[model samples]
Target: MAKLALLVATFALAFLVVNASIYRSGHSSCERQIRQEDNLRHCQKYLEEECSDSPYNRPGRYLDSCCQQLENLERECRCEGLQHAVRQQLEEGEWEREEARELFQVAKTILRKCPNFEEPRRCEMQSRRWF
Candidate 1:
């Protein structure tokens, strides 16, 4: 009778151990998912901030670096649908062309304001000259 009682206790302990491990693994996975989601949100917010007053929000140019940053952010995000959509938009050649035009306009504006806007070259998106 005592031996049977010991066997039951042993089985219960083993079951509890296995259950605890599974719970820990699942809990870690949930935490990771939450972190990834947060990262995606942060990246989106950054994109919004960078484009807010820039030519990227206007009709002509695509903020080349901004677009590239979005791509990188998307890659780092690793959340399926969000990453895919961003990748698609950034990769579109037409979209790049539009971005280049907008950037050119922005650079032109900066050059006017600071005559020595030494960084105009960086804003030059060479995808295609709309002129």
Candidate 2:
């Protein structure tokens, strides 16, 4: 009887630990989503405010360069947001490893296209660290 009780206790503890880990994983996913959302929003705001006003609104070399950079930044932010969403799905056990890996590769591709935007990257990194 004592051994049975010990087994039950051990099982209960293991269950709680697994549950807690899953819960934390989900929470982290949500937090990462929020962070990515905020960064993407900021990038959008910058494009709207800065690029919209630039003479590049027409078609010229300067405008082309600025627009290209702006587009790259926007794409990077968007990819990070997508990665967070994919991670949430992974945490929920709804996504396979291949899908999650593909999504991560997409995000990495986006990140590779642009130089690091320090402040935004820092926020995104911190939020994803919980995983």
Highest-TM-score candidate:
2
Cα distance off (Å), candidate 2, residue 126: 24
Candidate 2 least-lDDT 10 residues = 43-52
Flag regions of model 2 displaced more than 4 Å: 39-131
* 44-116: candidate 2 lDDT, tens digit per residue: 3322333233454432323233323434444334444534544553454443445445434433433333454
Q: Model 1, clash count?
A: 6
lDDT of each: 0.42, 0.45
Model 1 TM: 0.31
**Model 1 lDDT per residue over 1-131, tens place:** 99999999999999999999998886566445534454334333333333345454543233343333334432223233233333333444344444534433443232223232233323223324243
The list of candidate 1 runs beyond 4 A from truth reads: 39-131
Error of 1 at 51 (Å): 25
